[model samples]
Target: MKKFLVPLCLFLASMAYSQDDLLNSLDSTQVDGKTPVTAFKALQIVTLQSTKMAAKKEFYFVVSHRFGTVKDGFDSFFGLDNATTKLGGIYGVTDWLSVSLSRHTLNKMYETGLKYRLARQDDHFPVDIVGYSVADINSFLEKDQYPGLEFKHRLTYVQQLLISRKFTEKLSFELVPSFIHKNLYNPDIERDNQFSFGGGGRYKITKRLSVNLEYMHNFDKPDFYKNPLSVGLDIETGGHVFQLIFTNSQAMNESGYVTNAAGDWGKGDFFFGFNLYRVF
Candidate 1:
């Protein structure tokens, strides 16, 4: 019995030592240094959604405004007399997925969308890729105004593949291949389907300030509609971001803004606008 007790004690000591060694090894383990590179600092590069997304459990509120075109000059106070406003909210379900809902004053449009990150910029991937889907509904369209207007005619859909890369600490670029489908259109005046390519970039000038430019070109669009061009300055302060923008697009939603913009940049028809956003 004494011999057995001695061996049992020796075995217990060996087990305790091994357990301590295992814990020590775990405590000494180092974190991986190859963390993925973040592309854009903000959730949006300008009017276009950026490859970056809201972090998990985070929410963002955005208020956007675009006044009438400066073509009206002082009569409209450089387009301030008529303003299109949008209120939007986005919530992150996970680190790489987010959903958003927004309402715009123009056309009384309501939009809902989902954004998902497909590939992140890391040691293995050179660019960040994201997929975005949006549905826009125009509620102000009255059947009385246009006889035979169907309910499905009020809906438009947009799908895009967003690809971007941060080339330097201060420079980031993005490209979006977009498809827009509208159910209602004046057959001779508009097409049911359109394709567009959007490009944008941001140049950081200061720690909290950036210069952004965005443009979208639609293929086979009507001669009356011009492509949209926007230039803006982004200001970041704590949990708030303010964008001072100049744009040729008064419509806020993807389908309307991309396919139906009437303002021409060459004619000085741009409008002054701003977007105030906050994260909570």
Candidate 2:
């Protein structure tokens, strides 16, 4: 028994010495500018869903220029010829929740909104549904005209339902149901403040390139000038997205396009617009 114990103790000591020597050799090699073989490497594993998650916070600013019919010839003098700029930012509070604020330079239209994902598409469910709301403030008009004004006047409210579905790997479409409520309008102009429906579609041509088409129709205004329709192409590169579009609608804001679009597509009055997006 004593002889066997002695041999086992010697073997254990030899193994410990071998490990210590190997560790010391590795340290010396690192210090001497030599690469050492490693049994395992530090690695990061990311799942497809985790890698594809949207950014936590995103900021976007776009300058949109519209060139078409001018309501009055004076517009040409001011270079208001047909130009509007919009600055917007989106903040993702959580993985599935986000909020956005935007201001249109045209007529000082300010909008704040929130978005939440209700359902995500998976192998069992083929559709992705998101809920969104936007509150628009139109600060162009005056409210103290009436002799007996009772309540403080505020701008109109526009609500929209954004529905998106992925039909294929490269194609997706969205349908929007919008409602607009306004208390007053210009006496000379005829407009309706009612619920409306709009729809849009997107087709992905490549990984970072796609085409979008959107149309909005006013159910209350059957005799209104015309519905608004826009078609555009988007190019996404790194942190910038450039959009070039052609549309018959001349209005810059949501309410303007939904209620006061006066341009005609058949008469060759459609205008070309460009949107440049930058992030810092």
Evaluated with TM-score, which candidate comes out highest? 1
1-280 in candidate 1: lDDT tens per residue?
A: 3764485466434433332222113113333554476667667776788897887888887778888999988898888779788999999999889999999999999999999999877767799899999999999999889798888989999999999988887898999999999988888977899999988999989976899999999996899999888889977554345678888888878888788888888878888887766666
Clashes of each: 0, 0
Q: Per-residue lDDT tens digits of candidate 2, residues 1-280?
A: 3764485466434433332222223212341243322110000000000011123564433345565454344556322455665666666677567666777766677877666766655545555555666566766544455544333234666666555565665565666677777655554555436666766666768755677777877776545467787787766544234567777666555666777666677775565665544432
Q: Lowest-scoring 10 consecutive residues by lDDT in candidate 1?
A: 19-28
Highest lDDT among the candidates is held by which one?
Answer: 1
Model 2 CA lDDT for position 90: 62
Candidate 1, after superposition: displacement of residue 57 in Å?
1.3
Candidate 2 runs further than 4 Å off: 1-54, 70-80, 143-152, 186-193
